[model samples]
Target chain A: MDEKKLAIIATKGTLDWAYPPFILASTASALGYETEIFFTFYGLQLLKKDLDLKVSPLGNPGMPMPMGMDKWFPTLLTALPGMESVMTSMMKKKMASKGVASLEELRELCQEAEVRLIACQMTVDLFDMDPAAFIEGVEFAGAARFFEFAGQSDICLYI
Target chain B: MADFDEELDASGLNCPLPILRAKKTLAGMESGKVLHIIATDPGSVKDFEAFARQTGNELMESKEEGGKFQFLIKKA
Candidate 1:
């Protein structure tokens, strides 16, 4: 039987948004599907060597307040200085306590599984980012190259 | 207790971690060998079933005891 393939386009850069692509790709690989992720736009941040991903609660009503403060927490407070860092630390702690894999770990698993990691060359040049800023084993390519693989994939997703 | 060739303790992990660990363990085992797994995530019940179905691994047993989920998967 022919191997199944999964193609993904990751376009977000926030802390919360980083998990889906790596988690899905690694899991898909574990499920015996050949997986590839094309990192474009803000998603290029995920490929950087230093992962400083943060989550901002501003304008996000769905963000639950920490320390049982959700019921009465005001949205305006999320705009205060350093609130993003506070929320980011809290989220990191929560995820660590819950045994959720770190973004780095998941990405490493994807690499170990041989899931193709492709960086959008156009986005890199447009943002004036150096290719060396990314981790090793990343293939620099464009939309056409991604389409060559995605067109034949059994599943394709944009995240 | 069904006999198993390997044991994977995935306690405290959530979502895809448990399933991923199981998959990695199964990959190194020979076909027809049973793998016993213990997980704490409630979602693993359905996730393991779906994983087995998609990967062709045989889920020999799946049960819960005292809030922990257990699964015996025979490698395909």
Candidate 2:
């Protein structure tokens, strides 16, 4: 039987938004599926050589406040200075305690599993992002290139 | 108890880590060799079943002990 294929379009770059694409791609590859992740717009940030991903609590009603402060924590306070850093740190600590893999670790696993990491060239040109800023082994391509592979995939997801 | 050629302890790790580690271990084993895995993630029960099905490996045994989940898979 032919190997199954999975194609993913990653469009989000936030800390909370990063896990789905990498996790799914890596897992699918392990399941014996050929997998590719097309990084576009903000999602291209994930391919950076140095990752400094951060999460924000503002307008995120679902985010539970840290240190047992959930019930009375004011949404307006999320807009205050340095709130993003505070929330990001809290989330990192919480994930560490839960034994969740970091984005780097997941991405590395994907690479090891031979999952293709494609960076959208248009986004790179539009954002003026330096090509050298991205990690090695990334393929830069256009939407047409992605569609060529995605069209033949048994599963295609936009995340 | 099913005999296993290799053992993987994936306690505390969540979601795909356990499955990913098991796949890596199984890849290094000879065909028909059994891989014993112990994972703490509840999601792994279903994940391992699906993994065995999708990868064509045989899940020789699966059960819970105390608070942990144990699985024995024969490499395909």
Candidate 3:
């Protein structure tokens, strides 16, 4: 196969929504593809120091839980004590059962592959997120700047 | 005795993380060495399968038993 460059646009903040771009971008990098991940809208939460810490399962209908509980659990499960951790644990267990990697592992891969992670400046300003809340080394830029980078990519994904 | 020789416990991470970890782990492996990864993310079943095709990692096996995800990946 020919060498390819992939550009990932991570656009959501939920745990389920947050992981794909990071995973795909990392794999693309591993597969000898140059990769760039641009986080916009709620997607910037994944790069936040505290956001990824708490994965809210709001509006998650397919979330797996003990006793198939996620299916019947109240929509407000995210607000219950230890629910996020339980949910994150449930998610982690589910992913592990599927041969998926860990969050810690992904962080290392992001670093090792030098995956360029950028946060959309407009989203941050609109959300009123403190600049200091994000992970270190996040490239802060505008949509035009990000598109300039994506223009050169062979794969462009929005998620 | 090598890092590549052991099973990688990637269980408990969400999507993309499981795949990301596998990629990094595979990087240090010699081509043809088998790397094991265990995850608990349901999305991983799809994520890893897609990852295998994209990265050319031979996903020799993927099984989900009692809520645990397991795989034997051969570095290509």
Candidate 4:
């Protein structure tokens, strides 16, 4: 059988949203699939150096509290000032306790597994972000290159 | 211990780590070498089977003992 190819488009910047693409890319690579992730728009934030990713629970009613807190409390708390940072910290702690790898760890694993990381050139220009601001091993490309990968991929995801 | 070429204990790791480490380990070993892995994650059962199928490795043995999942994979 031919090796499967996977191409993922990552367009979200938040901490919670960042995990899905990286997790999928790394897992797919582990499965011996040719995997690449195109980071565009808000997803460009993930590749930025020293970027502090945060979770915004405000207006997000689906945020689950591991302690099984009622939705009302989180809804009310998220409305308070600085609550997003608080929620982000809480979520990180919860993830750590669960033995889940951190984003940095996952990024390293992706690199080790040879998963290609592509940063959108247009997004960098639009956001006024320097290409040097991104982590190492990132290739800069436009949507045309992304499409080329997507066209041939067995699994294509826009997340 | 000598029965397997490499022993990977992914006991506490979740989701892709078990499979990721196993894949990395397998990459370093010669073909026909067996890798023994112990994992506590319930998802590992399906994950390993799928990994074996996708990578064309042979899953020689898979069993559950005392809540831990054990697997023996022969690298192809």
Best by DockQ: 2
What DockQ would candidate 2 receive versus the native complex? 0.93
DockQ of each: 0.86, 0.93, 0.33, 0.87
Tell me what TM-score chain A of model 2 achieves: 0.96
Q: Residue-wise lDDT of candidate 4 within A115-142, one digit each (tens)?
A: 9999999988897998878999999999
Docking outcome class, model 1: high
Candidate 1, superposed: residue stretches over 4 Å from native? A67-71
TM-score of chain A of 1: 0.96
Q: Given the true complex, what DockQ would model 4 score? A: 0.87
Query: Would you give the TM-score of chain B in model 1?
Result: 0.98
Q: Candidate 1, residue A142: CA error in Å? A: 0.5
Q: Quick one: how many clashes does candidate 4 have?
A: 0
lDDT of 2: 0.94
* Positional deviation of residue B38's Cα in model 1 after best superposition, in angstroms: 0.6
TM-score, one value per model: 0.96, 0.97, 0.64, 0.95
What range of 10 consecutive residues in model 2 chain A has the weakest lDDT sum? A63-72
User: Where does model 4 sit among the CAPRI classes?
Assistant: high
The local lDDT score (0 to 100) that residue B57 gets in candidate 1 is 94
